[model samples]
Target: MTVLQSFPIPRPTTNPYLIMLGEALRRTPGVTVLNFSWKTALFGRYDVYHSHWPEILVGGRTPLRRLTRQALALMILIRLRLTRRPIVRTVHNVERPDGLTARESALLDVIDRQTTMRIRLNSTTRLPDGERFKTIPHGHYRDWFARYEPQEMQDGQIGYVGLIRRYKGVEGLVSAFRETEGRREGLTLRLGGNPSTSQLAASVASLADGDRRIELHLAYLSDAELVEIVTSSELVVLPYRFMHNSGGALAALSLNRPVLVPDNEVNRKLSDEVGSGWVHLFDGELTAESIITALDAAAVRADRPDLSARDWDRAGIEHADVYRAAIDAGHRR
Candidate 1:
């Protein structure tokens, strides 16, 4: 059997789901993998064409460019339809186009009409055209966790990772870290990721100049550096104001490190379903006092066993099943 997997290039972060999907397909006997571009012409030879990307509707200026691209994509879909080869789309996120113009809405309608199946990461997302959709959670890069070495505790050391965006609640984390800085012995806050130095400094500038516990690594981090930072810390805090599903949180969970997330409904549901006692949810407002209390609790339970084994394998097997089902459905049609 032949399978063509199409993905977008030039993304800053490596997508672990694509990696896992490729690996799982390779492991299946009698299956051949093909990586192709979005504009590639389809010969009538391939058995399946599986596309992975967030569902996007073209908007903004350059309607000509958009039409050209859409024409090529439509040609590929027509080929699949003619050959009866199943076209499966993995929906990472079906983002509404910025400004939500009429043209964008129409383009989305076109895509909904063309695609056959959608695999959703979160179960909450609505289906396209009321068609069949499968829910598969994201997986972790298990190999990256092997390089991590636990760091010696320095009392109140706290760490946060990932892109330091406004919605990420970095300000909350900093305020919480500062609240316990002098009150606890050896209290330190370490911030790492690809945020601009000026932006990061501006966020935490209110802290005293002499505060030694705060360390910031405001640059793109390699896998080794990320693993080291996550493993060494007593607790990894995700204080997200909103989370659909967190890839970073899963990465830390794979390393058996405890994570402190806000007590949102989503986090609460995941914690209960996964039996992950390590995920602590904050109550009341996400004030410095509330976050500090959660962090202290997380510090005590940092050594908890990793709860990732089941979820990781389950996500992998679920994708494998989706691939097989797509293949079978195509053959039947």
Candidate 2:
């Protein structure tokens, strides 16, 4: 009943989903969780190999370099397939395709066809080569919710968390916060999270330079710091330009803090299902003035209980089941 689990460990990045998966595996009898590495994992002996987010491995590299790496990884995966060892891949972000060259895409296509099981967070993701794909909702760190103490509703503090990417709409938040100038009572925007790129950092800093109220921590945040920021904030807003599923939104809800997100089809579905009125639906007209108006309104209704107790526990258990199903299916084949 021994199982080998391999997942990427990115530095200065705390993947709560990966950590939760490892914890779930540890709880299961006769499962061995192994750290994922290129050279080691390819050669390691195991009953089952579960890889997370194959898209990321193909992304963020130069075209030539990405092609080369994909070829190498594909070769290893092909060899593993020939051995008939069960391999399962979990697709974390199916909302966006990996920036891959034609060759890399074809290579991944091959692997996807051969892989025994494909796990996805959302049920809507299409399977590659008509392979077996299962739906698994992402999990949150259970301890993150325990550390939160609801702060007194103060007038000026707003919090935003998650990887500070341009698409995340941090600039929109900054613009909206600026519009609140002189109109609201001491409005301050406290941004805490990892910035994916230097361009994003510079962009945020440039906006925050003159404004003392806008405090941006352009560094990797620990779990404790995350708890502190989320719990202390008056309201948490996820002003994403386009978001598939927000880990930030779930984290905020786990802390009993309300979240304000754009009213997209995906977000609206999640908000409605969770019964959390915390979501602020913004149509295509998200100007600085419009956003400020929304923020002002949210300040008053921030304490409204939007999320139901059912949605929270259901998300966690669904994730646990995905892991178990992957393992069980491996044994079956």
Candidate number achieving the greatest TM-score relative to the actual structure: 1
RMSD, model 1, all Cα superposed? 3.8
Residue 269 in model 2: lDDT: 67
Residue-level lDDT of model 1, residues 99-195, one tens digit each, is 6556546655665665667787766666646687788766665654565665555445566778777667777777667676455566667778775
Candidate 1 pairs with clashing backbones: none
Q: Please report how far candidate 1 places residue 213 from its true position, in Å.
A: 2.3
Instruction: Give the Cα lDDT of each candidate.
Output: 0.65, 0.67
Give the TM-scores of the predictions, in the order they appear: 0.80, 0.79
lDDT of 2 by residue, 9-73 (tens): 53446577666666666665545566676775567766666766666555545768776677667
User: How good is model 1 by TM-score?
Assistant: 0.80
